[model samples]
Target: MAYETVIVEIDEGIATITLNRPEVLNALNSQVFIELGEAAEELSGDESVRVVIITGGDKVFAAGADIKQMASATAVDVSTNVRPSLRTFNFIENMHKPVIAAIAGYALGGGCELTLVADVRIAADNAQLGLPEIKLGILPGGGGTQRLPRLIGAAKAKELIYSGDFISAEEALRIGLVNKVVPADQLLIEAKKMAQKFAARGAVAIQMAKTCINEGLQMDLDRGLQYEHKCFSLLFATEDQKEGMKAFLEKRKPNFQGR
Candidate 1:
């Protein structure tokens, strides 16, 4: 499907969603959120798509939310317009297929929050990431406050958010905000490589594992273990699981149908 603010491409078993508003540094807006949610929903329902990558042009992942859109808005306007946009992030996070963020340049405010929704994030060496909402007399309303602390630690997240400082890709890596940082030119290549690795796995198992990890994190250890156990046992009923085990016994790579 064609999108005005974003581009969606599917190849092999990977789907890539590119934010296409470079004129404004690919700033997030209501339209961007709408398109993103549509793209994610469409890809999630496609059986052929094993993984999804969200990215922007080489110059930036996204600078931030469009300030102009919010500048003249009242609290009621923001609640009516901006708040609903967060559903896109939630959709991406809960997608059955893993979502990877290939970030370059700046990923600030809402952009940073966007990356947090991805299952994995790989950034360019030149990338800068932060939640600088406080600098604008606002706070991150797009999951940054929640996901950031979960990814790094609460203290680090607080420091970054409170200071409104941008962290280098290396610093982000050190703080565990991003999975890996590569040369700018190789960012997409690395992202695609990781996506391909996921594509080759048992799709059902991969989705189940993602569910277990994401949902399990919200529960106590005992409850989480029980949930994991249930998900694990449920997979035994899938053809992919049976094929995977048989393939292992036969000393061959398994062909997963994602059933």
Candidate 2:
């Protein structure tokens, strides 16, 4: 689909969502959120798309929210205005297919929150990620507060958010915020490689695993285990499961049709 602020390209089974607007460092705005949500929704229903990658081109992921747009907002306006971004983030987080963040340059404030929604994050060596809303006399209105702590750790998340300090891509990897970091030129290549790996897997199983992990996080250990048991048992009814076992015994790769 064509979008004014973002571009969605599907090649093979991998869908790439590029955050356009390099002129402003790809700042997050209301229009961007709406387009992103629409694109994500469209991709979520596409059976051909097995995995997705969200990037801000090669130069920058995004600097932050459009500060100028929010400079004069009142409390009521601010409260109601953040719904689009929050809704978009939630859609991305709940999408069945895996989503990867291919981050380069700065992914600050809203941009960092954006990456938190992805299943995996691969950063360029020159990337800088942070929640710098504190510097703007605001806090991360997008899922940053909840997701960041769950991802890295409360202490580390708090340090970065409170101080508004941008961490290098290496530091982000060390803290487990990012899965891998490569040279700037290789960021998209690595991200697409990871996406391709996911594309090759059993689609139903991958979706189930993502559900178990994401939903299980909100449950206690006992409940989470039960939920996983149910998901595992349910998978036995799929055609892919039979093919997978048969292929294993025959020493051949199982051809999954995403059934």
TM-score attained by model 2: 0.99
* Pairs clashing within candidate 2: none
- What CA RMSD would candidate 2 show? 0.6
Q: Note each model's CA RMSD in angstroms.
A: 0.7, 0.6
My TM-score estimates for the predictions, one after another, are 0.99, 0.99
User: lDDT per residue, candidate 1, 83-119, as tens digits?
Assistant: 5568899889999998999999999999999999999
Candidate 2: regions farther than 4 A off: none
Error of 1 at 47 (Å): 1.0
**lDDT score at residue 174, model 1, on the 0-100 scale:** 98
| Candidate 2 lDDT tens digits, 47-136 | 999999999999999998999999999999988989999999999998999999999999999999999999999999999999988988
Worst 10 residues of 2 by lDDT: 132-141
TM-score of 1: 0.99
Residue 180's lDDT in candidate 2: 96
